[model samples]
Target: MDTWRQIIADDEKSWVLFEHGTCVVLTTPGDDLAAQAVSVLRDSGPVHPGTPAADFGTVPLETTPGWVITSHHPDVLTYVSPEEIAQDGDNTPLAAGLYGRSKRDQDAHSLTVIHVEDNRR
Candidate 1:
């Protein structure tokens, strides 16, 4: 979350409206051009993830009704049904876009989706 990393000299609380939607940032977007930037950020990272897990290997375990980890490769995919979707209502997270900041690279992959909410803070 570069929004949290940047050191701004001056700022005021103004909404950084995400008209585009939400993004599910994956572990990586896969681009050789981003290798250098990734390495740099990886080396410089003291960035607090805020997530409960301390590291990737120790990702907090949560049991959802639809989940399984393979012994050979440990892959995961969840299945959601129409009933679940209806229950989720407007709170469900779904992809909305795929964008690359630099033409040469995509830093990471993310699932983006547009949502409606009152940001009147």
Candidate 2:
């Protein structure tokens, strides 16, 4: 049910993320992050697998411009922005690094894995 559409920049062919029935341009990445943003937008966001027992962190799904990172994965966490934080109402967007329950300051949040197609060849 997550509908999507995109617009490429005239000069650079950059990606502009937009959803169906809305003009809220979520992001304008130079590459496929725009598609990932759309997928996350259609979904609940930060789609995560069950937490691992090792208490580790994983990479974050590259999110849209207005989305935030609230959970941690046990592999490769990434960076998010303030605008994304405010939009998602995430009080603590974890910085890209090691995360787990062992770390008193970081939450053991997890993220869903997303496969991005590399069209650059």
Candidate 3:
């Protein structure tokens, strides 16, 4: 089976499984990529199993610098600088449209923002 299929089958991680071929895995600020892959699945909310991946195409998370968003899907991820986030307002429309009043609403999807330490500084 494919890697994603295997992961889905295992169901042992914090995965925002969408209907399309896209999946967003969440991790704590201190968790490494490898660690997150195998870590026990935690409780996640606002799972939109019926929503298409295209709806999340523009949602951006405000995180610490150096935090990278990796994805196998072409053109599925983008880096949003702090300046851009600030200019967009306290709460971005894109995020509001998806997350709604509660960070994780039953009617919309939720995003988990992880802030990693900048070791270079």
- Which candidate number has the best lDDT? 3
Candidate 1 lDDT tens digits, 20-99: 21112223333432343234323322223443111222121133321111111121112222333355353222310001
What is the C-alpha local distance difference test score of each model?
Answer: 0.22, 0.29, 0.32
In candidate 2, which residue ranges exceed 4 Å CA deviation? Answer: 1-48, 53-75, 94-121
Residue 120 shift from truth in candidate 3, angstroms: 26
lDDT winner, 1 or 2 = 2
Worst 10 residues of 2 by lDDT: 1-10
lDDT of 1: 0.22
Give me candidate 3's TM-score against the actual structure. Answer: 0.22
Q: Give candidate 1 misplaced runs (Cα > 4 Å).
A: 1-49, 52-74, 91-121
lDDT of 2 by residue, 15-35 (tens): 222221111123334355544
User: What's the C-alpha lDDT at position 102 in model 3?
Assistant: 27
The C-alpha stretches of model 3 lying farther than 4 A from their native spots are 1-51, 57-75, 91-121
Q: Pick the candidate with the highest TM-score.
A: 3
Error of 1 at 60 (Å): 24
For candidate 3, write residues 1-121 as lDDT tens digits: 1334343343443443322222444433233542342222112223344544223333334334311222223222233334434545644545433332122232123223232121211
In candidate 2, position 121 carries an lDDT of 32
